[model samples]
Structures are given as C-alpha cells and as structure tokens.
Target: MPILVEVSKGLLTQEGEREVFPKIAAALLEAHGLTGNSFMTPNVIGHVSVKPESECFVGGKSQSLAVVEVTVPAITFPNGQVAQKFIGEVTDIIDTYKAKPHPRERTYVVVKHAVDGPWGIGGKAYSNADLGAAIQKAAMA
Candidate 1:
C-alpha cells in the first residue's frame, strides 16, 4: 500500500505535515481490521508533497486543496464497506490538520486499486494471491 498526500503549501503546520503519514496508516489499518497484523503493521509506507497554493489547482484554477490518494492492490480493500470507510478516515485526517476554514469540498480522498499481477514490491510482480502469501509468511516470521 502506498499513500500519497499532497497539500497546498502552508496549509498545514510543520508538525501536522510530519504527522500525516502515521495518522493515515493508523486509520487505514484500523479500518481494515489489520491494525495489529504483523505484516500489516503501523509502519505502512507513504509520501507527502506540499506545493504552493498557487501551484495546486482545482477545476483549472489554483486552490487550497488537501488530497490523500491511496493506491493498493485490488484485493486490499476487499469490499465497498471497507473502501468507503478508509476513504472517509483519510479525508478526516486531512480535515483535522488542514488550515482553518478551508472548504470541506477542497479536501479530497481517493483510493485506486492496481489490478492483480501488476502490483509489485521488491522487484517482483505480485498477483493478489502472491501478495497475500507473502504477507502471511512475513507475519509468521
């Protein structure tokens, strides 16, 4: 799983920016009921990109927006309920730390699932089953 967080520059406090990834990971793992899974630990990987408000845009016009985009293998979410909850939690994380008074609509959360056999890690292509097995193996170690 990879989470990409993009926020308009200065929209979040320095501390908030530093805390975003862990916040997202915690919410995601809890939502998926994998909070304590050894292989699905809180050490989830993510990245944050902050750009000037002038450099970020909505509808072709620059705007103060906070976007959290999560990409995971198709099997990760497993169902609409889990996916929906995850997206909501993601939005909540951004909403909590974003500059005060930012419009609710300006906070966006998206989840994209890579098709089986295309998601890769450690230089190897992994189908959903392969990834599941790998995770299981890691948990047992």
Candidate 2:
C-alpha cells in the first residue's frame, strides 16, 4: 500500500501529521482483517507533503484542504461498497486531526488500485500471490 497525505500548510498541526499516518495504516490493516500481519507492516508506506494554502487548489481556487490518497492492488477491496466505507473512515480520521474542522467535501480521499505486477518494492516486483504468501508466513510466526 502507498499512502500520500497532502495538506495546506497549517491545516494540520505538526503533531497531527505525526499521528495521522500510523493511525491510517492501522485502520487500513483492520479494514482488511490483516492487523498484526508483519509482512504487511513493512509494506505499508506513507508520506506527508505540506504546501501553502495558496498552492493548494479546490475548484480552481486556492483553499486550505487536506487530501489523502492511497494506492493498493485491485484485490485489496472486495467491492466498491467496501472501498467507499474505507474512504469514509479515512475522512473521519482526517477530521479528527485537522487544525480546523472541515466538511467532508473539503477533505478529499481517493483510493486508486494498481495492477498487481506493476507494484514493486526495492528492486523486485511482487505479485498478489507473493504478497499473500508473505503475509501468511508472517502471521504464522
């Protein structure tokens, strides 16, 4: 999984940025029923990018907004409904951390699916089966 969190400067406190990603990562694992799967832990990566409000746009106008984007393999979510639920949950998490409360419309969350073989780590590529086997092995240990 790859998580990208982009926020207007001052939209989130420094402490909030520090707290959000780990919480989001954990929520993702829980959503997938993969909590405590060590193989998955190392694969959950995230980054936070903050830009001045003038540099962030909404409707072609600059605004203070936070955007959370996650990219995972298509198999990660069983269906569109599940993906919607995940998006709602992520929005709530951001709501809790935002410096100023914003409507759901202001906090944008996007989920993108990467076709399996194109997702890579280090210099190697991993298929869904390879990832599943790694997670299972880690869970058993």
**Pairs that clash in candidate 1:** none
What lDDT tens digits, residue by residue, belong to model 1 across residues 66-133? 98888777777777898888787777777777666677788888888777775556677777788788
Q: Write the per-residue lDDT of candidate 2 for residues 1-141, one digit (tens) a residue.
A: 899988888888778889889988887888888888888877899898889999999899988888989888778888777778788888888888888756678888888877766558777778877877777889889
Q: What's every prediction's RMSD, in angstroms?
A: 2.1, 1.5
User: What's model 2's overall lDDT?
Assistant: 0.84
Query: What is the lDDT of every predicted structure here?
Result: 0.80, 0.84
Residue 124's lDDT in candidate 2:
72
Q: Pick the candidate with the highest lDDT.
A: 2
Once fitted onto the true fold, the runs of candidate 1 whose alpha carbons sit more than 4 angstroms away are 138-141
TM-score of each: 0.86, 0.91
